[model samples]
Target: MSIELDHTIVPSYDKLASAKLLAELLGVPWSPTALGPFAPVFVNEGLTLDFIQTDEDFPVYHFCFRVSQQTFDDILGRIKRAGISYRSSVRGPVDMRINTDYGGNMIYWNEPDGHQWEMLTVSYARQSA
Candidate 1:
């Protein structure tokens, strides 16, 4: 048997708002769903971004994305232009540390629902890309 990430279901309080925020942040669009009390976004053809509006605070999860050095800088620029926080990285701009263990070449901030989100320059995703 082979295992892979099909999709993720996240607890959100305002799914529409969360979806909009994520779409803008990730530079993607949310697809229409049948009972869209949730909005679904695709990370690629394989994985999905699912939102579920709930009450209890969901534990913050750290996820990463790999981009070219230029793309990463542009994203960082956008984050700075938006007046968001960019903590000094222990590993420098090419690499960012989130805590110490769950670290990557990243820039992170709290999403609307307080989820720790990030964008990284190096993708530990696939060996090829």
Candidate 2:
């Protein structure tokens, strides 16, 4: 049997706004769907980013998206248009920059909920010996 990720719970102070922001940034469709006490944002056909409203402090999570070159360009353009600050690396200086590491373009930014989000055009692969 193959293993695949179905869904994940993302804690946010404002579920709807956070979900909407993510959807718009990623150019993905999202809708409000009641899932128990959580409001889920369906990022794709196979992945659901469930936003759980919370008041207590929680650890910030990092999410990465592997996208095509065109998709990456579109998203990056949107980000720049929105005046969203991005960085070449997680700990690097904040600026509108993209890293050409691993022979792929990558940029890092944070959502409304302060979740670290990364978009890359290529996936990092390990060479077999």
For residues 1-129, write the lDDT of model 2, one tens digit per residue: 778799999999998888888888888877766757677777778898888889989888999998999999999998898889999988788967899977889999988778999998877654234
lDDT assessment of candidate 2:
0.86
Worst 10 residues of 1 by lDDT: 94-103
lDDT string for model 1 (7-107, tens) is 88878888778777776666666855636556887766777779888988678776666766676676666666766655444234533333323344556
C-alpha lDDT of residue 24 in model 1: 65
Task: Give the top-scoring candidate (lDDT).
Answer: 2
Candidate 1 ranges with C-alpha deviation above 4 Å? 32-36, 89-105, 123-129
C-alpha root-mean-square deviation, candidate 2: 1.8
Candidate 2 local Cα displacement, residue 103, angstroms = 0.7
Q: How much does candidate 1 score in TM-score?
A: 0.70
